[model samples]
Target: MFRISVLARRYSTKPITSYFKLFPQNFPHGGPPQDSFIINPKHLRREYRNLQSENHPDLNGSAILNSEVVSNEASLSEVINKAYTTLKNPYSRIVHFIKVNHPLHLDLSRDEISKDLIKKFQSKSTQSSLAYKEILMNVLEVHERLELATSEQELEELEVENEERIEETEAEIADMIKYEIKDWDELMMTAIRLKYWINIRNGIKEWEPGKPMNLTH
Candidate 1:
């Protein structure tokens, strides 16, 4: 199970500045889009409860229970389910925000990723599932490089090497909202690098030899 509070904290540490760029508060000429109205979790939950009370098939009297009413209730229930699912998951929420607010027009240059690299990543897998293991291995390799980095200047330089690619990927995401792109693979690679560097930097800050208490403040 995923922890929403943990994700919210992570995002707070690295807030999405680009979100405001993509979804501005107001335009110069007109009002915001209909979908731009933010759905409050409390309000949604209340609405759902109210809907259930009204649509409960058990609630029977002289009221003519039409088939159309039942169908509409089902549809509303489906919408409620979808809304809850999207709101609960951070990744899904992000994707939904992009889809609703800023549709992209992406054009991919590469047709296929390197098969040899894919094979190498696959071979490194100890079990039948290769994906998680491959990501972890990539992160480990980057962390090793970061450990060898001597100074803050070296770390900054390493970060600069990735900055351009990260920016390009962000732009690509903005443009190609609907289409698949080879750029996503590049973004994942860069994310792994960033994650490793972050871990290594934290390790250096809390460096210690033998004692368990060395990591304490």
Candidate 2:
């Protein structure tokens, strides 16, 4: 059994800057680095807690001194916390991975809207853009489904069936991410679908029968 360690555990530590010149660069964008995609959450969490023990000024074990020192520790702690949060979740880690490792694959430049998923949002300038338009088309379609789910039976069925879609995308991503190198464009496409599926999941979880939802994922 993988004995999962609790994040809130206390330990002895030091000021991160006191020991090193650079902050933890393992997450943020372009981490695990450009060559790596798969992030072991357990490993990430272990590193995170270690850094948290040192950089986290809020923790008594993380050593606080004068006010100026406290401020610097506070800043380091903020960055570390963000990095840990981003790395812990599968979806966010994928987004950051693409941003860091393969900017060209994402190809934010060649379109009217720019790389805010340019391929998906582009206005039918090419065959692929036309297909990509389904991102929004699907969202609206699902929204209609959600609106029609005015009963618990319908909502239950909706989530139970829709969950498979999310799981499939996740499995695809897991397979691709296994390679340290990959076609980031394909991952991006899959990730975008995963995002919408997640939104639909969230919309369902938050919704109650007869109560309207904005459903804007």
Candidates in order, TM-scores: namely 0.29, 0.56
Best by TM-score: 2
The alpha-carbon deviation from the true structure for residue 160 of candidate 2, after best TM-score superposition, in angstroms, is 2.1
**Whole-model alpha-carbon lDDT for candidate 1:** 0.38
Measured with C-alpha atoms, the lDDT of residue 66 in candidate 1 is: 29
Per-residue accuracy of model 1 over 1-217 as CA lDDT, tens digit each: 1133542343222222222122112211111232322334565455445544765542232221322223454654564455556543323333444333322311111112223223433565465236646656655654555556666676676566545433444344334333443343343333333333344445555434332221111
**Which pairs clash in model 1?**
104-177, 105-175, 106-176
Error of 2 at 186 (Å): 2.7
Instruction: Pick out the ten consecutive residues of candidate 1 with the lowest summed lDDT.
Output: 105-114
Off by over 4 Å in 2: 1-80, 103-116, 119-127, 180-182
RMSD of each: 15.9, 12.5
